[model samples]
Structure formats: C-alpha cells, structure tokens
Target chain A: METDLFEQTILPHLDAAYNLARWLAGNEHDARDIVQEAALRAFKFFGGFRGGDARAWLLAIVRNTAFTKMRAQPAQDLGPDDLDKIEDTAPQPAQVLERAGNIEAMRAAIAKLPVEFREVIVFREMENFSYKEIAELVNAPIGTVMSRLARARAQLREIILADANLRETRS
Target chain B: MNCEEVRELVHAYADGELDVARSVDFERHIANCESCAAALRNVRALKPAIRGSYYAAPDDLRASVLRFPSSPDGVRQSGGLPAAERRAGSWLLTGLAIAAALILGFFVGDAFLRRSANQNLLAEITDAHVRSLAANHLADVASSDQHTVRPWFEGKIDFAPPVEDLATAGFPLVGGRLEYLRGRPVAALVYQRRKHFVNLFIWPGDHVTEIRDEKPQRGYNIVHWANDGMTYFAVSEISAPELRQFARDFTTALSH
Candidate 1:
C-alpha cells in the first residue's frame, strides 16, 4: 500500500528531479549519483509528507542532495558568493539575440551561470514554474527570485555575446 | 508607473508575474515608452532558447528510480554499484537520515503552541487541497453516484462522510479519495465548479466549531463548518461566496 502511494505520488516526478539534479551537479555521472541518493532520502522521508506539491517536494529533496555534493566539492560550481565576480552588465541586446539561436551556445551559457542563477533559469524556463513557485522551491522571497532571474538573464546574455565575438574573431 | 519603475518591473511584467491591476498600469506605461517596451522584448527573448536546454533522465536512471521503492532498503541496496561507492552512498544516507530525524524531532516538539491552532489546521487542509490538484490523484474511487462514493468509504475510514451530487446547483460531484489529515483518515470528496475543483474534506469530530468567516490562503478560498458531529472543510480556487453556497447546499442536501 505504501509502495503504491509512493509510486503514485513520487514516481511521476522522476524526470523533473533528475533534470534539477543534472543541472545543479553539472555532470551526467555526478547527476546520476545525486539523483540516486536523493531517491533514497525521499523514500526515507516519505512518511512525513503531509500532502502538497509532489514535484516541488521531490525537487527540493533533489536540490538538497545536489547541494550536499557541491558542498563536499565547493570548487565544482560557482556559488552565490561568486556572483559579484562575474560582470553585471551584458553585451548589446542585439548581439545577445544573434547568438541565442545557437542551441549549443545557449546550453553552454546556462551551464556556465552561477548555481543560484542557473537554478532560477531552469525553474522558470525549463520547468515552466511561476515565480511564486520558484520562490517556494528555492525557499526565498519572490522579490529575490525576480532579481536572481534578471541577473541570470544578464549573465547568460553576456556569455552568449562573448561566444559570438570569439566565433567572429576566429572567422 | 514611471519608466524607472517600469524598468525594474518589466521582467515580471513580461513573465506574467504582475497582478492584473499592476499589469494594466504597466501596459499603459509601456505603450508610450519605447525603452520599457524594448526591455520586455529582451526579457522575453531568453525563454524559448532556454527551454530548449531541458534535460530528460536517462533510461538507466529511470530504471534505478523505479527500483527504489520496491527494494527493502531503498536504492542503496540496488545492485551494480562498486563496493566502495555503495559504502560511501550508505554513509551519506545515514548522515541525511540523522539530520532529518533531528528536524522532525524539533517540529514535533514545537507542534504545541503553534500560534492559533485553527490557523495551522486550516493550513494543513489547504495543503491537502493543493496536493490533490497537484498530484492529479484527486480520487481513489471515481464515481459520480453518491451511493457508490458513500459506500466506498465504509471500511477505509471510521466515519461515514456525507456525499451528494450537487450538479443541479452548478457544482457536480466527481469522486472521493481517502486522505490523512492531522493523523486521522478523512474522506475528500471532489467536485467541479466550472473549471475549478473543490475538495471537501470531512472527518468525525465531537465539537461543533462552526467557522463563521471564510479563510483565504495562497490564492485558494476555504470554507469549513460542522454539522452532526462531522467537520467539513471545502477548499477551492472558486469564489468564497460560491464556496459558502456549496457548504450551504451540501448541508441542505444531506439533511434530506
């Protein structure tokens, strides 16, 4: 009975959980490990679930698991503190849009965003979660989510433009 | 809204996060402001490109996840992991379990003096309503017939939850599911109001704590009332007046 409930509530979110873990961990092998570990933790904590958004609940577990791994290897990704080190101003909007169409460039730009910014982007764009949902998922205020998403977009534009410039220079 | 305010809010305006009033004001300002209009376009441009980067789980990962609940000790017991990897995984799992236990202990200890006990109770009911909608697991027994839905709850719960088809009143009975609220099994009856879903949770109670005022939380309206030793909490995104009417109609129908 418990297993049936677990499958019904949690299994449907497997891809979502894995996608969040994959982006946060930044590698297929580590993402797989993080997801596996998170699944174990989720099963253990299943009894305490008082009924709410199952996808959000599962993704929260996945985020915690990924953060635990990242904590062990702090150098793996740029943490929130590293946000200031990157340039705040993006390149020209036209330049950014020119490069946005390139799938690989967009993917790489997203992969290069700081963990905090990357998460909001993934939640807002890939998962199609509302800002309110993103705030709850990240345990932050809605204003904070908005600013982080803005900063994430700015940084993504910068990265894509830089890629465009590098490709132009080479050609 | 001025250009400065519009600049700060253009992203939210583009993202559809602004409330209707603010959105109307924002559009009015943006219509005359070229820079603000450009800002909205710039923010909107990233969406389609970013959506293309979504990653799906690999087949092996799906297989492993499917194995998680079936295994007695969960996924850590799944085969094919190196001995050292399994050891490390179990160590991490142990650490997480201990941390979770500590958090749970703290919450249990602080469960008392929860500042207005009724508020917390309503919050739990609200959460269950959201869960029913979010999980798409609205009903364990899907039946529009009141007789079928009423008898379905017989052995699963200790109390008989009042069920009725309110279709004639513009709120049709859909189904009912067994839910756990405050550690007791309760019956959650699903009803449809236009495109909205109303979850009416009923459980046996001795006290008649009639809720005179409706409660609104997280964009959902809730109406709770007690009759004949059964407490009912009906939660939905529908208007409070309509939900209040639902409560009245439900009680009126049950009295017959």
Candidate 2:
C-alpha cells in the first residue's frame, strides 16, 4: 500500500527532482547518482511521509542528498553584503531584450552563481515557487529568499553583460 | 512608496509573491516611474530565459525511477526487522537498487545509441526538437515579434526563411536558431502552441510538394512541405489536426 502510494504521489515529480539535483550537483553523472540515491532514501523513509506537497517532499530529499555529497567539497554561500559589491546597475531593458534569446549565456550566468543564490533563482524563476515555498525549501525566512533572489539577478545581469562585452572584444 | 522601496519589492512583484495591497502600491509607483517600470520588465524577462534552462530527466533516468525500489514484497520482507537491523538492511537494499539502476542504464544507453544511428529525417527532427528544449538551447535569437526574429537570420543562413508571428492564429513566434539538417545549415523557427513548441525547419531545396500526410515520429507530430524552392518541416507534440492548422496558417501567412 505504501509502495503504491509512493509511486502515485512521489514518482510524478521525477523531472523536478532531477532538475534540482542537476543544478545542485552541476553535472549529469552526479545528478543521476544523487537522484537515484535520493529516491531510494525516500522510499526507505516512506512511512514518515505524511500526505503533503509530494514535489516539495521529494525535492527536499533530493536537496539533502545533493548537499551530503557536496559536504566533501563545500560551496561558499554569498554574503548579504555581497550585494553592495555587485554593481546595482541591471542590464538595460533593451540590452536584456537583445540578449534574452541567448539561453546559453543565461545558463552560464546562473551556473556561476553561488549555490545559495542559484537555488532561490531556480526555485522562483524556473519552478515558479512562491516565496513561502522557497523559504521552506531553503529553511530560511521569506525575507531571505527575496533578498537572495535580488542578489542572484543582480549578479546574473552583470555576468551576462561582461560575457557579451568579452565576446565583442574577441570577435 | 519611495524608489528604494519599489526597488526592493520589484523581485517579489515580478515573482507574483507580493500581497495584493503591496502589489497595487508597486503598480501605482511604476505607473509614474520609468525606471521602476523598466526594472519590472527586466525582472519579468529573466523568468522565461531562466526557465529555458530547465533540464527534463533523461529517458533512462526516468525508466530507472519507474523501477525504483518500492516493490510490495521487498517492503514486506524488510518491514518486520528490528530498527538497527532494518537500518543496515536498508543500506544493503539501497546498494542493490543502485547496482540495478546502473545495469539498467547501461542497456538503455546502448539502445539509445543504436536508435540514434538508425534515425531518419523525422526521427532526427524530433530529436532536434527535444534537444532544443533539453538545455536552454531553444533559440539563438528569441523574440515574439516577426520583425525582430526575421532579421536575426541575416548573413547567417543563405536564404531568408519567411518569419511571421502566428500569435493572431494562436501560435506565437517564439524565436529562431541556425540548425544543421541534411548535412548543411538550415533555419529553425520556433513557435509556441499553448505549452508545446513547434519547430519549423527550413532550407533551400528544389523538391516541390504540398503538405504531406502527417507522420507521427517518436510521439511528435511531423508536417512537411516544399514551397517556392524551400523545404519545410513543422514538428511538435501538438495533435495532428492542430499541427495541420499551424502548417496551413503558416503557409498562408508566408504567401502574403
């Protein structure tokens, strides 16, 4: 009965689980390994799962599993004061419009972000998670999620502009 | 609200996470403030561009997940064990599961290459469509406006692939990319049909033909035609009739 429920409730979120794992682990091989391990762990702890957001529950497991693997090589979190150092000048709307289609650059920028900022961006922008949900995922207050999102976008804009300028210089 | 407050609230506003009253206040400020409004637009644009990077679980991973260790007997056999013993057994079980998934992946990986080697035109087109969606590679020049998307192909492809916004007909022009098909570079125009994407591949060719019978390849609907010396293939996951409508409307739009 539990196994059936697990399949029905948690299995549908495989794509979401893989996406989070992929972004966190920063590679496909590790992502696959992490997700597989996470899925087995989730199954083992199936008895503890009360009926709630299965995607969130599964994703929380995925995140923990990825972090455990990353414990060996810790990722530095961005400080709140880092925003001051990151120039507040956002990419102009026109420049953003022109570069918006360059998904490669955007991907690179997101990948380069610190894991703390990167996760919030992924949750809010890609997964369309609410601030509350993002806070719950990261175990932070809603204010922290909002501020991290701001910093992430600020850094992303600068990184994309620098990349574009570098390309222009090269070509 | 002051500019500082608006700047702070813009990300929340863009994410639709702000409360109604705060959102209203933010909108009111942006109504009169150009910089604030531009900030809002820039924030909004970031969403879709980031969403484009979403990685769908690979087929093999998905297949392995379906076989995840949740079998009833497996659970029952281990269900009555002591707490410490169960913990040890679970680790053993987890090890077995990983081994099983790895073995499955190897076979699935083999089948994947074999499938790729024998892929036909329709198969290749469907793969390209899937690949575009896989890794934030949907478009080299993403835009909804035909004027913007059309000119982007200049000096890139040899010939102009007729670009038109089908938004009026429910299929909006999403963007364009330079795709290599038939061993040469071709123009791939992407359009949005509801949630699904329609990839229209175009290249210079002398083969003259009308819209052929819809061929469903690897679960994606394929519609192709030759017009005015250009070969076109429209591929999407939308229904056959809907894809036909897209082709007819697209062809009609190009003629004008």
How much lDDT does each candidate structure score? 0.75, 0.75
Candidate 2 Cα misplacement greater than 4 A, ranges: A72-77, A81-97, B70-256
Interface RMSD (C-alpha) of each candidate? 12.1, 9.7
- Model 1: per-residue lDDT, tens digit, A24-82? 98888888888888877787789988898887888988898888767743344433532
Error of 1 at B180 (Å): 32
Error of 2 at A125 (Å): 0.8
Runs in model 1 lying further than 4 Å from the true structure: A72-95, B69-256
Encode model 2's per-residue lDDT on A66-85: one tens digit a residue. 88877733346455532343
**Could you estimate the TM-score for every candidate?**
0.55, 0.61
Predicted candidate 2 versus true structure: per-residue lDDT over B163-202, tens digit per residue? 8899999999899887654234478999998889999999
TM-score of chain A of 2: 0.89
lDDT of 1: 0.75
Docking class of 2: acceptable
